[model samples]
Target: MSTEEPATPQLQSTVSKPPKVFSCVLCAQRKVKCDRKQPCSNCIKAGVSCTPGAPPKPRSRRRRVIETDVAARLQRYEELLRRHGIKLDELDDPVISARPGVASASVDGANSSHISAVVGKDGLPLYAPNNLWSTLSDEILDASSDDERDLAIRVANQSLDSEPSTPPKIELELFDLDTPLPDLSSLHPEPLQIFRLWQTFLDNVHPLTKLIHAPSIQQEISRASGSPQTFTKPMHALMFSIYSCSIASMRDEDCMEILGEDRALAHRRFAGIAKKALTVAGLLTTRDTMVLQAFVLFLLSIRNVYDAQDLWILTGVAVRLTERLGLNHEPLLDSLSVFNAEYGRRIVWQIAILDGHTAGRARIDTSRTLYRGDTKFPLNVNDADLDINMRERPQEHPGVTEMVFCLIRCEFGSQLHNQAAIEGNNMLRLLGNPSTPVAEKETFISKLERIFEEKYVKHCDPAIPLQLLAMVMVKVMFGRLRLAARHPRRFRDRGATMSQEEKDSLFAICLMMIEYDNQGHRLPGMHKFMWHVKANFQLDAFVYILNELRHSSVGDRADQAWREILECFEHHSDVLTDTKNPLHVAIGNLALKSWGARESMLAHLGQTLPDGEVPRPISVLRSQRSVGVSPGSYSSVSDQRVAGEPTQNQAFQVANPTPFDSMDSTPIDWEYWNELINASGIMIDETQYQQPVYDARAMNDWK
Candidate 1:
């Protein structure tokens, strides 16, 4: 018990102790256990650049020692089990669920192998590579915002209408008076052949009648697997072919082809094609397609292949696309500006003149001297001049009517801005003529007036104000208001030589537009409409209309137009009222009031109105008297109509009420007024319609 063991002394090593190994950065940052399997356990744990400490030399399991005791026991057990009733192959292999947190135990532990990677929802192998799978997963999981969707749509839109690999071939058909002559003056026989080929091409294509019924081929191509640009190509090509056909129709198609072919019937065939093509092309909302179509239309117009109608249709296509896609885009405006500047004004004027011709119920004399090249007011036509009679004589041309229709469609229905400027002036110039005949002038003025007061007022946006003003000016010119007010001395000095009725009429028209404000008289839509009209039609035509209305002479178109307008207004007074157009109603009432007051004109107006109801002008005056008065005062009061009213010559004085007299009159009596006030109530104003006449005048002066 007391014996002690000998103590051993500590031995010092010559080398210093080895430094501690650090974990790999990845594992250390995460504070997770690492295999440390690379160069060292620490390196594997950190997920750092790990390399095998040495080459991965395969180990021979065969060389390892066998557990003979366990092996012998297992083999003996298996042999005894097999004799009892069990087979070694009968045991089923174990499987693990794909979901994590499943059982770890496996029945076949004797045979172990690593599991294969998993597949993802999008059918891609998600577990194959860590780097690639994460990116794919993030994209698949993230939702797209509204702006992203729009961006994608825009990207698709921008790609449509790229030029085809082939040089965009076209086959133009010719019909009687339809084919377009090559710009080259040289006559050729091949053009006719080309025209026939164009017709044949259209028949084969079986052009679309409506956009909703796009051909099966076209629909299929758009949906095919290709870029949007490629998809829209067939449509664009079809449209171009149609345009070519329209151009051909204008040529002398019936003229024997250089090869002796009669292609007069080609026009109808090609027109059909053009219509279908336009319908298909319009389905596209992409910027590139819109611009291309606009450019093509412009070229056709300049080349005289397409008339005003064609230009109008083409313009509609461009404007609709631009609006649908959003006009703020730079390319759209750039293209529109070019089209607007080049022939824009001319097209507008043409439409205005067309409106004048048909609505005014007069022959629009394009032959009248718009200008003489040597004169200060040059009668020269601009490049934009789409005048139907520019190179032709005064012979009645059927094309003139067509051209007018074209102008109307283009200006009124398509490019509204152009229509406002041109159509307004053309209407006024035609209506203001002294010799225009009252019947014709009245019809024209009435139609023109409705478009502004009724149509434009309700839809005030766009260039409606300009249109409204134009209508107003034409109305005044028909009545000779501007000329009489500005140059009263001319009427007084030449009273005996010229027609006094014509002078008086012009003055009356002017008075209606020149409302008493803080300032002197002014013309509505005059400056702006004139600016555009003068830029295209003969500048003097505008000045001349004013001058003619002022001077009053025999055979004066202004005089003729004034009479025509008054007569028509008297005829359609009731129908005009339903329009609920304030301007039209006001003018109608004034015209009727003047006529009913005159013994001579009363008979004329009586014949115009429905079976004997007092004219509106007389009715309005009576209403004003009883506006706020007793109810019984609303009676017909036939007594006042018979005695108080002045004759036709004196009738004009109502509009010329002295400033003091007008101020003395009380505001309209709302209670006593029934039908008159009722009519006014139904009228919807396009503009605020609240500015005092003076304010509009001041702005006019400043301008």
Candidate 2:
């Protein structure tokens, strides 16, 4: 009304101005005030073109329709297929849908229908034309009748009931001990061949335990050759066992040439024959010393071939028989021949060694079985020093015969007396008792250290045979390792807890042991011993050194140690590849993995360092050096000396007293003996001491 038309009456000056409320399109979209000029303020700040336009339209509010039925059906089908381990992607075939009542159909010129189509006169349907059930009797389709339907349901129910609900279990066959024995005469080799094998056994295996009197065995062999019928089953078993081990100990190529077959196969055949002879001879039920000796020999023969548990159980049997026959007690010199009594003493000590060794290896506590107070160590003399009549006694010299070294080893057996300590030292048991007092743990360590110094260090001769020296060193090192592994502060920083000197000493011992093992094969008769145990010693050293490298703060030392260990491993690569000792092979591969991991860590560290900076040696705590002790020289003990009494010159003495000492005691430190036993690497679960079959392949795979 106030426009130019109404103002026409007063037409003086009625000019109209543009509205300020209107804005440019950009400003309206941003909901900001605009100047309404050609280029608005907001458009100028945004550096965009400005244009006049209408307001934005409101979005429609239409509701979406959902297919709930289809969704529910799809979920149900997915669930049904999952129950049978079937996936949607696997159901590509039209005939294999998860939905029920959806039978596939086929089309033909004559008929096209689903698989459930009506049957024809020939009892065949066009649908499912290739189905074999189409030719079945029409009675199959007569279930429409009440009686037929009831029968069909009953049959289906019966069939379901008959089917096993769980998968069938597999059963393993047991060893057949009753297998017929091979012909003894046919199995017996020529006289020269037998002599050669016997010599080989004497040179290589007998030194392990000089239980069998060589002269007596030779006499028996000579007599048996004169009269074939006199060659008893025990004797046959003994010869076969020796031959088997002798052949097995030879170089693979040499064994193949001698046996004209693969070394393993030949050994198997010989071992089988030996086992049969042992069964037929009834040695397990016999008290004959020859049979006992033969059985023990058989145990040695199978040390590397059979299950460790089997050997352990067999050793137990030998111990029991020896005890029942009074071998564990001093022989009555008045009642028995001197040769027989001496031989009995030898056999008893041999069994003791075997018992202790097997128990240690199997991780089985032999404190109960090995406690023999009256049993004395055999005389430190060679087999040649004694006559059949025992009238000639050779003058005893230090380290002259193998018995001297053996008795030195036997001295370590005394530590087994502490049953609680032995049981507590177990790796599994130690790990479980994490909260055990540090002081209490130190007591065990101190005890082990004392035993090591007195028995092995003070009493062991450094100049002893390389093999014996190696054995002593390995036993001592293994004992130290066990104690360290059980130490409460083992995982703590080295400088804060375990001194650098202690670490260096431990590492040095490991290096020495590895070097010793590298040269072990060169030792005379060393091959006759359990090479697996030696290999395991190498592995243990490797593990300890690896731990050192991982924990050592001194970068240069750690790097140097790694190089030495890696070189050691490479040097023994041939032995590691020997398939005969699968355990060693597995340990070798594990060592390689550990080495690779160490190298990767080193590489990472190298990359993380500053470009031009040299790595400085980290602060690794060093400890004071203690007095270096060597093994004591062996001194002969008189037969007149009471059992369990340390010889006048011998440095080892029974430090700790046990409750059973007054009952039946021996010089053997049951605790030290136990430690030495475990050093052999023959681990077996106490619960599975008598496992019927030990799957070595499974053990290999497990490692």
Candidate 3:
């Protein structure tokens, strides 16, 4: 072509297209521009040839179809649900979790799969490519053999079982997790005695606690009693705990009559054995649920002997252990037998109540778990109704069942616990927070009372011992809470504005607490719970009445209050004659001062107490202090007073101030007061009543 152009003279008229060119090789290698000359400017600078290169291949753009993907997924789900006979439109119904006609959870019977279905976040599973369990399970499910498929289904149904994760072997040897247990034959009571203890537990502890499945455990206890050598560690711990609780619940005279053994000696013996059994059972680390049950039972039995503060801390550990076992969550119970699941619920509920009670006793904040626990209350059913072999949960009883006592208590406890956990539940909290209208508090309390009455107390048959206990206990708690809601300190931070009517109401409520407790002690049917009643009788109510009588002038309500007080004191005369601890002596001294005031007022009014006679408590206290001895008083408690009489004056006065005495003008020491109450072996209740939010104002002026 060049030659022809040069010769152009012979010009062929047709022109040929030149070959297309892009960046030069040298420019391309340097990622620089090429001028299209055979040797580009960059190449010329480097004194190298610029080789031409082809253009880059075009990149294809991908179109995003997020809406299309979502639609497809939704369609796929709808089709799947349709094929499974699910009503997609009904998916949003509120009652789906608790559909009609389904039985509630049961502790005794095995639970069959529910006919109603619930969708779960994890239902549409997408197994990872390398997940070994998922792959193996899928293979098993796909197997042609019916045995393999059945086995796979069975394994899948056990939702309680976590996926097996292969962990690195721990070959290091330092301590023995499975140490050889000591010979426990001696700890095992005789077979006949075991039956007796079992019966006692069923009669006394089971009705209130309802923690044990009586029928299932009865057989185990019978076998274990005769053959201690055959006992598992957890069951062994449980058996000993049962014996300890039984003996602890019995009175000394009852123990002597029934077992021909001293109650105190038998309790100490069995309780010590129970401690050993818990240690052997590995409660802190064991995954077995019975170990926790045994631990809780042991705590309950030792309540009278154990320090409240330490017990509270120990229950904190129990609560942490409960969380470790995932008991506070409900869905984790999926696939478990109805008996096991319901018992698990019972265990956690009991632990919660114990934790709350101990915290109340210690006058401290309750466990935080109370605020957030989602575990449902135990189904209202009897011990005989729950069976390990049952396929479905039994229907909840409409009337009373073995669990009725626990159910009612659990409901009230859970609500109050959660309420106090967030908003300060006590009136004393007004010191810090803007006070809630007092009327609002009364409204809430009245509503609570009505709900409690209609829902629980209405169904109770007072003729039945357990039902009567429930009714009385609920009313007492309501009364106590009502008093707390209307405390004098809440009227004004310093109580200057407390009306006489409210003061009278408070006095009446305090007296009522003592009266109910006295009644609990008096009733022959309530004899089993007498120990509990006596131990938990609050000092607050006692101290309040004494303080009110001493510090405030009486109104028209005083006569009735005085009569009730003396009557209650007469019923609980055991306190005056039983001990001389500071709390008790303070009671003695305050009553003395309060009685003096009452007499003066009576003289001024030309009247006298009930029969113009010295009350039993006042008479007994005066006689004890004057003579330095009283009837049946040389026991462990009152003996301390008689022994230390010389070092301290027998005459009680402001020299030894009590919790109600602020004569020194010093700030109130709640901690010291709590210690005094604890030392006196009085188990206080938390219920937002004790552990009052201290006010740093002028409340120290005790009158």
User: lDDT rank, highest first?
Assistant: 3, 2, 1
Of candidates 3 and 2, the better by lDDT:
3
Q: Which stretches of candidate 1 lie over 4 Å from their true place?
A: 1-278, 284-320, 324-655, 658-703
The positional error of residue 316 in candidate 3, measured at the CA in angstroms, is 2.2
Expressed as tens digits, the lDDT of each residue in 424-526 for candidate 3 is 5543342212256556665556666776788778998988888888888877777766655665423322344554445445555676676677677778899
**By the lDDT metric, which is better: model 1 or model 2?**
2
lDDT of 2 by residue, 1-703 (tens): 5465875755544345434446777776677877888777778888988887555568955321133224323543553454344544456666555444333222221122102224321243222221111111112212224443233333223323344212122111113443444577677666766776777677666765677778778888777764545787778777887887677666567666555677777777777677676766776677677778777776666665554444656777887888777776653532566566777877766677676556545444444445363555566677877777765445665443566445544543333223233455643244223345434544554565565465345644545553465455435444443434332122312113443334434455555555555555455545555343342444445555543433231244444454555555555554333322223322332333333334344444453222232211110000001111111111112111111332332211112211110111112111211222232244322211211121122222111
Candidate 3, 638: how far from true, in Å?
Answer: 35
What's the TM-score of every candidate structure? 0.22, 0.52, 0.62
Model 3, runs deviating above 4 Å: 1-181, 367-372, 417-434, 491-494, 551-560, 570-574, 578-580, 602-613, 627-675, 678-703
Best candidate, lDDT = 3
Q: Candidate 3 at residue 418, lDDT? A: 38
> How would the candidate models be sorted by TM-score, starting from the highest?
3, 2, 1
* lDDT over C-alpha atoms for residue 344 of model 2: 80
Each prediction's Cα RMSD?
34.4, 36.1, 29.5
Candidate 1 lDDT over residue span 308-372, tens digit each? 22233343344344345434233333355433322332322232233222211111121231111
The prediction achieving the highest TM-score against the true structure is: 3
Which ten residues in a row are the worst by lDDT in model 2? 618-627
Candidate 3 root-mean-square deviation in Å: 29.5
